[model samples]
Target: MATRPSSLESGRIHHQLGKPRGLLVSPICTSRKMSSKGPCRRGHSSSDSPCVENATLVPTSVRTHSENSSLIASSIGATEVVSQQPISSNVENLAVSRMEAIGQSLSARGISQQVSSVILSSWRHGTNAQFNSAWNRWSRWCVQRQVDPVRAPLADILEFLHILFQQGLQYRTINVYRSAISSAHVPVEGAPVGQHSLVSRFFKGIFNIRPPQPKYCTTWDTGKVLRYILSLPRNRELSLRLMTLKTAMLVALVTAGRCSSLIALDLQFMQKTKTAFVFTLVKPTKCSAASKTAKKVTLTHYPPDSKLCVVKALEVYLQRTKPARGQGKDKLTSLFLSFVKPVHAVVSATIARWLRTIMASSGIDVSHYRAHSTRGAATSAAARAGVSTAQILKAADWSSESTFTRFYRRDVTTSEFQTAVLASVKR
Candidate 1:
């Protein structure tokens, strides 16, 4: 009988034959030192050295595409087994690919790997999706013209931006794409793409042509929504779904909190005081980095109306959902849980939908405004009630008054301008 080829020889043949579609092969016999007494760490025969045959095949779905790419690139002639960790979000994968591209570009410049990692780490995770989108578009544009994306001439960059402008993109959105390019491309004339004199002037011309405007000119009255809430039956008599919507709306209006902040509320960080229920956000919010301390939202008892009391509604909701929360370690700790079976923590988008539902039910024009308009409505109502600017700022977690003035400040009475104009005209 003919002698069998060694495992190492088998692996090479397998690799040359090409890995099966949608599968990744794991490397075998990683150790260079062989055991004299018995098989090596991989338990291969002494005659069988580290080679292709020892590799095991795994499904591609087991690892994220970006992670698989990184592992394959790092290993030399051997495919390492990737960890079983679940794939991350699309944004995270995009971030990995962008960093890898940046690393490859820097490697030719004599930059060390550790320093490149540090440089990549400086970018915020929140901006990955935006930067990746812009970068991909720029790269595609460069490819069509047969130019290097990172080393393109200044005229090419300007031409790309001009094309974006022609596509009816707003001034601010185009500026974001510019910032994305600046982060990736090498500096032009010792200045970033955004800072270049020609680019700056081009942006100024664009802004002058199409000025930015606030999303809402006026916000609906909060009293209208409260009146609708008060009309609902007592919390005990209402269905779990209705109660959940009511509770979410009341907390949103009272706290003027964003959807992200609302979803970040966890029962683990909640406290019940003698007169108020306090919730502290454990997850990161938009302002988390700006403020050193954790943000707190306090809902106090409403002496004027027990039925409309947020604290009371919240307590009743928790009591109603107690059975659904289950028990012990597996119990859900999130403040908001889905009202359906197999109930679990709700995402930020769910909170926004609930708010929008409440707005529609209360007769607010959902077409002209969104769930986020609740912030402007509540703050405007508070201002009309003579609440100080400082108190409004503190409650809304706004660091500057300018933010409120530019974005949140709006006429509480909708159609005021139309009413005024129509009233002045003769019938």
Candidate 2:
């Protein structure tokens, strides 16, 4: 509009607005009488006020006739009366479009598909659940101790690990907590707090104090296990359930695959040959995530008369169960399912439960044997049968012999060659 008075234009304009305590002064209407610094009567200007020399005192109702005239004029100078109008819709839309274009260009400029995938994976919920859990535990611990959790000192992390160790947590388990906390703290701090040199040395000391013990497991008798499976009750209600368990246990033993890999299997991954069905593990597994290509395991069928044939068990189970079938993969269909209502994909825990059921039925202590024991048992049996190390390693999907020899290849029956010779001579 009109030129704003230097005194009234500034933020300190209450004095120019009659110093009203409860009223909001309108910015327009310069014809209204201007108040001076001294006490003055209404509709009058003091001799000291600039309005006394340049502006005429008018009634409160007096208004400018021109619709486009300035609402207010300066009392000190003949300031131009600039007209005020609402901004055009076109101008607002153009401004918004320009801002959106700039934002889109900036967002798309440096982001490639690979970079976007990596960024998304970094913050993805599935990958960071462990981190979140670990952080929450540490935060609660910090709260109990009346210490800051997020900016925890390196010493606090070492103490936390020490506490976990004292609670009988394995070295690897303590390290998992450390890794999770360190990863979460990296965004707030430039570096991981637990990875500090002093903290690492503390970890080394802790490890030396309480080294992790190798977990012990008992192997299963493949022939006896098969016989047990076949002898299970074949009543209408239990036949399908036993058959599915038999097929699952046999396939797991034959392939020497982990529960994760077993539950992830689908019909699309299997190719039938003359004597065997080859299963390709194209999906990422715990061990194969870093590998470039998928792995394959072949399960050959036994003779038609043999009751322990994995192929036969699979065929019987497939025939009994009603999996959704189509040309391509049916996402709703899984290799394994619960016999209960609303059949759905079996998780790794389900496989573990099935293995426990099988183990418990065979007079073996189920607590001492886990589902992963299948891999060890199969590899050890192959080794005992004069199978090559490389063949066993390949079948077990092991990249090296250390894990096979140290962990899987346990001498449950024989301690040494002399004991074995004595036993053989006595027999």
Candidate 3:
């Protein structure tokens, strides 16, 4: 009965407590309070009624119900902890996404840098300088207009072209400006100026309006120029500067060498043979691209009595100048050195200026002639000397006869014209 008395006792004492309010108290908790036991988990004495005052007592049978309610509250708290897991997971996912985006950005930038490096390496030295100049002008124009240069609209390009045209820029210079604009937009912007229909149409109209003018440099007569150069007295009193100029003229005239390739000549590349001297071009010429096999110029010596011999002139120049330190030592180790203090390697511009100085000294008006005229003069002379057209082409390293006909062969077709005249007279 004592064990089963809790249910009835709860019903009988239910009216004694009036209404069961506030916290539900289990029979175990009630018993602990009733008996004079140890202190509660809150560290309060059993004599203190305040600790038990808020708690309402219930029977043993209702004790199971109180336990079940407490178990439900615990389960709810566990569910809340579980719910919080997804928020942390979402935060982690957001951080991961941001990291991935940063990685992709760096990867793209690295690829762009690699592409820019390859493009720059492909350009020739002089061409790179010219492109930089063109790009700088375009950049300044865009800055003045307060517009972006990379994604510039087609209208902007057209306006820039109009400005250049009004400024009296040549047709070739205008084309270069277009090229610079196109290069600036492409790669990063994914748009090239050449692709625009409006730009293409405008260029076509420009070409039709102003046909390209054929610009030619007056031919330097090789025979008269060489004769005058040889007439200059060869004495110890002659400066190394004059000797250098004389050697340059003789080498350039005999080899028909390009001005760009002439500055690249080094003493290490030249070898004296029994009958003649051979010069090995280290870098490929503008016309030639094969680096594995370089082109060589073989100059045979003229008679000992002749002071006009290229081999003799080269030998005299070598003897007069101080010997260069053996091979591959410094950048200034070029065969040609400047006459100034702390002599440096001469560039193509310097070589061109030197050629003009020689022509001026020889009493020729060089107002209309360029340094390249030396190549034309040399090749043309070889053509007139009954040297086969094929041999002349070989000496000049020309892949096509068109360039020869257009620029080098400026002289009239005398043989063909004479033949036609004789036939007409006979008839």
Candidate 4:
């Protein structure tokens, strides 16, 4: 039997006091005088319970069975999650709960690992911000329309997308919205269908998205663009500033160098063995170069005496302006600083703007043209020069010959016209 105070001293005790009305007491005791009241966690009596305005001091989370209250808590690291109610077990709630779990999983890894998780999640769940926005709008629309969001057919999504496209959203932006719907894993409200099913149905024919055309600073005729670039203030401009930007873009125009790969290059990156100063264009810096950081990181000026003129311009800009360290020290060391001053490289936007200003000055109305027009012009120039379509593809870094044949290789078909004219002459 449990120990108990003497019935004569304790108001009443069952068995111990030999009284029929006596009851077993909890660790937090109450006298018969205050019998109607419950004992609190701290063992304090009702009149002076040491609580605030009749509230219990012990957290609701630790309340016992008699209180009929719920307790749910999450403990991680230095965090203490406290709750006083039961969690929902419905599918919608479960999906949200799982997302939080995935987020926590990502938070514990390295940056690359986390980025991989994000990409994977996006493939499965639509990670793009634009797509998320579209999903939200559609969700709200569904609620307003009284359509069961869970059982929404693919046609519903298409209808919503059409409405959005008509609202002046770009095809790419609309596509992003459609992409977000791809992440729908389960029915939103759990009617009869899963979200992925609806998504698959909705997106069966929808993945043809293109990125927005970035704003260019200037636009003009191809000839004007070239002239303006060639006329850059030479000594006043960084030495070879014009040459570097022009060559890089020209190379990008002619060769289709990735903006990263092109910008990450220097004269040293080339081979001095070639007469035209040809060098292997390697190391697109979207990711850091591994295994070559120590030896290949620095610029290798060629012929033992020639400093890349473009690299010289970069040195001048660095000494003059003291540009800050960027994501890649080796890559940002490009000689072509923006004419705007303080910025490191001649960015695509800046190049486009430069072309526009020069074209406007050179009597070309370039306002309607785009930076990509320069790319178009390069193909036109290559075709006019009778450069082999294959050579153009090689210069451009195209992945597929078909793409090069379709877009970059524009050799004119003059043979047919020539043949027809010759036949007439012969006749």
Who is ahead in lDDT, 2 or 3?
3
Cα lDDT, model 3, residue 389: 65
User: Once all C-alphas are superposed, what RMSD does model 1 give against the true structure?
Assistant: 19.7
lDDT (Cα) of model 4: 0.37
Off by over 4 Å in 4: 1-156, 165-173, 183-221, 229-251, 258-261, 264-364, 401-427
Write the candidate numbers in order of decreasing lDDT. 1, 3, 2, 4
Candidate 2 lDDT over residue span 1-427, tens digit each? 0111111011100012222222122211112222343221222223211110010011112221111011101100010011122232322121112112223333456666555455535433422443444454554344333334444566566766666665555555556567656653422345566667776787788669876554554454443354465466542335767777777887776677788888767767888776666778776666665535787767776563234566666666766775533235555445787877667777877987887788678654666666677677666655654567787777777789997886777543332334435645665
Strongest candidate by TM-score: 1
Write the residue-wise lDDT of candidate 1 on 197-216 in tens digits: 99999989997998766767
Using all chains and alpha carbons, the TM-scores for the candidates as numbered come to: 0.69, 0.64, 0.64, 0.44
Instruction: Name the candidate, 1 or 4, with the larger lDDT value.
Output: 1
Off by over 4 Å in 2: 1-131, 146-148, 187-190, 217-220, 230-238, 323-331, 413-427
RMSD (CA, Å), each prediction: 19.7, 31.4, 40.0, 26.8
What lDDT does the true structure give each of the candidates?
0.64, 0.51, 0.52, 0.37
Residue lDDT tens for model 4, 298-417? 222222112223233334444553444255545454534564545566554565554444446544556454444455445445544455556545444444677654443332234433
